[model samples]
Target: MEGGRWDMLEWLGPDASISVFNYLDNPADLARVGAVSKSWRKFVISNQFGKRLCMTLCPEISNFTHIQLWKRYSHQNASPSTSMDWQILERAHIAYTYFAHCFLSCDSDKDCIMTCIGASSTDRFPVESIHNTLVPTDMDHMVYWRSSYWSSAGQADPNVQESLIYHLKRGLYLVNEIRIRPFKAFFQVGDPIYSAKHVRFRMGHSKF
Candidate 1:
């Protein structure tokens, strides 16, 4: 009503309003926009604008068909009048808001690995230590990272699993993709490649 303070949503049609909101890639900006009015808040949450922005910025998670609230008992505290559908949308809104912010807040241009915590199993103490994985590239043809790659202890059963933990450069990071190149034992006779059939990643805080 006053100078420069008018509800744009009131003047613009739905399509135009959506087109305008589409340009906002920043999570903070989106949050501020939603706070402008109750209608704007509903529009942002109901349409999953945060999720759309996150997928647009991080293509790796674009395949996500659904998202659930991480805190299981959070729903128990909700008011009785809050419908399940609205609760779901609200969960998505909160989750995606933080998710997008995690991605945007970090400096994606640099390496995020700060240090290796430990591996579930290492073939050798120093030679095949999980620390070797930190090396970006091979140093010399003969000797590199003391052995050039990390190796897990031979497992009796193929079903056995191994894992490596690392401290990230920042406490919060959105790891959308991981690239792993299996180690090739060039010095060996057959030059066999050692790799896992599949790999998985997890993130969390370290216990003191």
Candidate 2:
């Protein structure tokens, strides 16, 4: 070894060592490699080995997933230090990749890839069932999304506009499209999803 230190991996050169690390599938192992030595850390981050492994693990994440969402959040939270840390950046990248996979990969046609985990609304079916089942999940009843749901109250006198604010528990999502399904009356002979004659939609990124 160069500085009288017994570098166990001294036999393998930088390029070769990276090749070996590239084979690591476990994200924890990659993170631990950084703590092993500064050289190993640099090697792992320089090639973004973690991000590569994440891509292999989640094939559904396309290049159009808008990586800028992650970058924007990362930069907002980043320290003022001059040198950028690719290792940290790669970790965030991998996290967002997995999060995107959770929402984008669907088995059924009605399964919306919307990452909306929770919702708040000006009106709901019943005041008690607000947060229970506003969005579709795999566990929803076979045909119907769920018996539990939300809906706007009376829209008469003033004809107020109804609004439902969906939330993402993970982080800022790079959403291209959002699917909305009107509720169905299960007791009816042919249970059908009722549609609103006209609907309005809006998207935004909020700091609060």
Give the TM-scores of the predictions, in the order they appear. Answer: 0.61, 0.55
* Model 1 C-alpha lDDT per residue in residues 1-208, reported as the tens digit of each score: 4478877777897889989999998999989988887788989988889988988877776776876555652546578898889888888787778778877765444467888889888888877788878766552323533575788887989889888888887433455567677878767888887778788776566653
Itemize residue pairs with steric clashes in candidate 1: none
lDDT of each: 0.76, 0.55
Q: Candidate 2's C-alpha lDDT?
A: 0.55
Off by over 4 Å in 1: 1-16, 58-61, 72-81, 98-120, 135-145, 155-174, 186-208
Candidate 2 per-residue lDDT, tens place, 103-126, comes to 445532333334433334435444
Q: Give candidate 1's whole-model lDDT.
A: 0.76
Residue 48 displacement in candidate 1 (angstroms): 2.0
